[model samples]
Target: MPLSLAYAADFPSFADTVFILPAGTTELPINAAADLPEPVRAYVASQLAADEKLISINQYTHHHYYVVAEAKKTADLTAEALRKAGNKLHALLKTDKIPELFINDLTPDGALALAEGIALSAYQFEGYKTDEKSKKTPDLQLITLVGPQLSTEKVQELDGVLQGVYLARDLVNMPYSHLNATQLANRMQAAGDDAGFQTEILDFVRIEALRMGGLLAVNQGSPEPPTFTIMEYKPEGATNEKPYVLVGKGVVFDTGGLSLKPTPNSMDLMKCDMAGAAVVTGVLTALAKNKVKLHVIGLVPATDNRPGGPALAPSDVITMYSGLTVEVMNTDAEGRLILADALAFAKKYNPELVLDYATLTGSAVRAIGTEGIVYMGTAEEQTMLELKQSGNRTHERLVEFPMWDEYDDHIKSSVADLSNMGKAEAGAISAGKFLERFIEGCPWVHFDIAGPAFLTAPDSYRGKGGTGSAVRLTYDFLKRKATV
Candidate 1:
């Protein structure tokens, strides 16, 4: 269960409480330590050893619960440390399943990080489970922070961002049966309604009428039709004259079309292929909720790449939304195809800048497995630097792949305008090179999140399934733009 967070203005005394202590904190904050029972006081003073540990103590009167969480001091508090501390605290809470946790004496940054760790650590995808008791997770219902500087505004903003992350993760983790293109579009529309944004979903008929050949070519395999989602958020008094466009590749489940992936783990986690779309939806949700003073647009072209009847195959050439042809060298390289259509369509906006996200290439995953996002951009140096800084701040570190002109040679086709698949070497850079063709010289950034979008094993605060990879990174970038 995701932790519900709110600022407790009245600050009621709960039967269960948690004290967050800094590193080497032998004594708790005076207010919290003074109210603690003698045994709990002695235990906190004696046994609260170090950061990244949680100790729970019980009181004799009514068996009240008292827990102490040790987080590294502010000077030592990096994003990784805060996340680790939150994960440690969550691991302890799983055994106790505390309904309400009140954390005392935490800074706003620490509280937000802890909330992220707690919420993400508690994620579980048990949609298919039949047994009610067996399909349970920790019920960490509400978490309240007690600190002098923890303002209601900060708490609300953090709560909104956490909700967005949870939503993105849930969308990415769902099975293809439950979250196909149409269903995903519906979910996007619902999210837009909730966040006061505008959503327009164009179905297959509209897609065909618009001649989105790339999307059509990919959907030729699956019985389920494709969908193109356009979402926009323009708050009153926004500063930007033109919107910032975000495009996402929405291959719901890529079995590689005619060029199929091998059985087992390779194809098993294909449901996470839509993580790019989920992140754009999530970032827009957060931006809208906080009413960031900037106009933003999100475009998602979604479909499942299966090997059913009339599936796309190698040597086939298809025209894209930009009226340029692409040689389908390998059907497995389908993400850029769908994304190409959306990227071309984004040119109509005349945006200040454009960014696209995708779990596009396995080479990216091989390059940096679960460590960071593979990023490349043609935007100004300052913009790119800001993005890298945002990634660092959010702990979604970026590994920059060069956009050298030499990579363009890898995608040149003998007959068609370009080839979907490129040389095996520097495969990730070649894929980015192919995407650059559709940008029409507009300042743009691309994020290949294949490495960090989904995980095979749980890592620290990121759970075993979808990691909600780029939501925080992109959200922070936008926030910086709005404020700076």
Candidate 2:
């Protein structure tokens, strides 16, 4: 990831420690702050007087130096707060070059938050930088958590989760030229090997034989053939008989086909279109590494949508894997096509639940900026509730929409079973309704992560490129599901 997390059995004394105060009182806590050098303590007090949200101070001694931060009062250290604190520490490390840092006097939850913040905020996409050595950002290689509450096991688990997030972020940030359909499947295969999972890649020949018309139709334009990647992790004594199937839209680059996207920033960032697939890959890696007692499956339908020869056009009718004819009213609505095939294929497993993630629609983005995800599903209320809770815990908040039968009417076509495009209103809901037609028996949830998947600007710990939107959300959900 952006930074590595280190642990120590006990760091009896470290100059650097974050001093957290409660919301109201400014009095020095009866803790480590008491032992800090007088000048450092006075400097912290002065910064507090100036109303600094976070203040750092370093005082040199004969052998070593001390680093301290005075933070504002927080009644209960929430995950977000810890993350923010971590971000503050990360900034200090980069800008001030404070080599050794310690987090003192935080509860288990508080320490985890700070760790998440620091880890998540430490990402940088310098893969193509030529002056790599000269321009590399100074990294915080070692972080020691000082307190009785710190759990070594929990810290390790969080590190695994961060590795997955970083992997997804890296995949999403890659240029489409470098990450094609075949390359995506290869990457998944490599990840499976590293994470102790099984991977199967279906090339153009296999995809055609299976009659995945939706994936094929979307891939008609690109010279780079399509690939369908399947990943599985099922161990003995797994909690569920049926696996949880995850489908991701791996449009490596979406040129919007014949419809074509607007020039510059609009189409330029289309490389991030495959973020959903990256999330699936990352989540599977985490689950495998953690050895969670649950069986899971991930499917990525990979391709690039372009206006090359034989590109899909408006009103084109194609039969999905489920044998339902879909009239493609808009070529740009391609994610659902590949996802439909995968969802239908998921029926083979009789999955307990099938969830698909996609940067599907602009309407969803318009409905909720980068604030949250727009999700709709036919899954049971209890399952949906669990997912919502997971989303909140991971800060990948979900904005649920109704999946009423009336919304399905928008996708009805005269000749085909359904149309890819629906009415202008509630476009996101209509897209979910369309995918619902393919899943006949199992419970399902369609995540329109368009809004929060990629950010034009950075948001806190989430950097400027791929946000790795739903990896944490799904990981937390599956962990809780495993226990239940």
Per-residue lDDT of 68-91 in model 2, one digit per residue for the tens? 233334323256666766776677
Q: After superposition, how far is residue 313 of candidate 2 from its true place, in Å?
A: 1.4
Top lDDT prediction, candidate number: 1
lDDT of each: 0.84, 0.83
* After superposition, candidate 1 runs with Cα above 4 Å error: 37-39, 48-53, 60-77, 106-109
Error of 2 at 284 (Å): 0.7
- Give lDDT for model 2: 0.83
**Could you tell me which residue pairs clash in candidate 2?**
21-73, 22-73
Which whole-number lDDT from 0 to 100 does residue 112 have in model 2? 68
* Per-residue lDDT over 119-235 for candidate 1, one digit per residue giving the tens place of the 0 to 100 score: 678767657888887777667888776677787888888788877888899899999999999999999999999998999999999999988999999999999999999999999
Task: Give all TM-scores, in the order shown.
Answer: 0.94, 0.93
